[model samples]
Target: MMFWLAFMLLLSAAQRGDAQWDWLTGIFGGGTTGSSTGQNDPNCGVAAGSRIIGGQYASQGMFPWQVSLQNLAQGGSHGCGGSLFNNEWVITAGHCVDGMTNPAMWRVRMGLASLQYYENGEQEFTVTKVIMHPSYTASAMGFPRNDVALMKLNRPATVSNYVNNICLPDRDASVGTNCVVSGWGVYDIQSQYFGQAPLSATLKWTYAPILDPGYCSQNYIWGSEMVSSIMVCAGYDHGQDDACNGDSGGPFICPSPDGSRWELNGIVSWGEQPCGAQYKPSAYTRVTAFKSWIQQTIQSN
Candidate 1:
């Protein structure tokens, strides 16, 4: 009788655990995600592709604020991308630095279009500190909430045509207009075996329109629960143009109404499985939602 009681207790615990897993799966969709990048390749080379699904190769110095976050743990391979917000700070996805917070083990490469090859104006900076959102909870099974982070550079980035800082959005900023996302992430999601080699070694970009929150939540297999108030969605329902692996923590840049400059509007957070899938749009951390928080953090730090 005692043995039977223990078995019942064990079964109950298992069921409860499964119930929680099921809930997350129902909200964020379920499927094993593949590697974020290929085995580390330090050699710089140009990528092969027409573009990011439908994007084009970016001209040198086009998006000067674009930067690459290199993982020294991964042999200096590009793990994720970021944007230079100012001389001393960069904004990226919190998930990008979740377990790899060692500042000495990371570096920021800016003013370069190619990952493997440094251009005439390329500059690399050592990271002094990493600050993730206090409420950030990185989950493999749930939406990446509060997915923003700031990296303090050891020295200020020299402002130039090829190394300018991107502007941030204000609290009242709204992005009804289409935004551009640039990165060196993989152009094809199915080429995981190729690893970092299959990725775009050169900078590439695609246009993803800002999606309505209500419509974004309803379309994914995980349903609307995957999208929180802090997140936003962009990409085609029937995938054509989208950002993929290695692109996380990059910017969703939009032009100012006056057309003189662009503002950082979004941070690449997470997306549906099999990136760029039909009817599956990618999600981003809405920058406006955290505008005040960003200000406070920068000031306090």
Candidate 2:
């Protein structure tokens, strides 16, 4: 009888474990196969199409790695955009968390396509730690240098059809390579009132092409030497589609050589005052330059 009781207890515990697993999987849309957790995962960067700044609305699961960094103190307002580095970490602009370094005050929302609506696959997590690069510099006259940052989630995100990680670039994308930048940023800069630009309710993306650093440096109001080696410039000569306010910290992703996966090449750093201004392309923090730093930081912390 005692032997039979032990068997029943084991069965009950197993059933409870299965039930808990099912509940979590149901929330994140995870399947029996489990969540994709690394860059090597075949499902990383898998999206419905190739695409984001004069950007169009993205469909569901179009950019699975996109993340909305929300400020809890401000009523969960979406402050900056980010990309999923992995199940436990998120990559974003350093300036986004500069003054707001308290991890408890921040939340990350993923698997989301709309800011106003919460979808079935959407996952939210409280940040446990915020790591900004030691060399990160915020400048009033020029774009921030070493603008990259990482936020550790309170819990690992479950990978699903709607959530995945983006692959980091091995090398810099060549000038003139077309890339996409996506966010829920402001749609109309001119329509803003009282110095406040309204953010988009839906995720939007636009195509931006990598531009020559020399040309970008020459065009900026700061003149030559404004565009640093660690930064990349991307936009058009006429400035039709460009990243604007509220789009900071988002990924500038380009297709790999074979076109099999998307690789993050840049992080939206800074831009001209009036967005989409002619001859004034936006500046992005070159991801390739800080690959080692990123790896070390993630590994040690």
Say which candidate scores most in lDDT. Answer: 2
> Candidate 1: which stretches are off by over 4 Å?
1-55, 140-142, 171-176, 192-197, 219-222
- Which candidate comes out best when scored by TM-score? 2
In model 2, pairs of residues that clash are: 52-205, 52-206, 53-206, 54-241, 55-205
Per-model TM-score versus the true fold: 0.78, 0.83
Across residues 37-81, which tens digit of lDDT does each residue of candidate 2 receive?
333344555564233212367666677889999989878888888
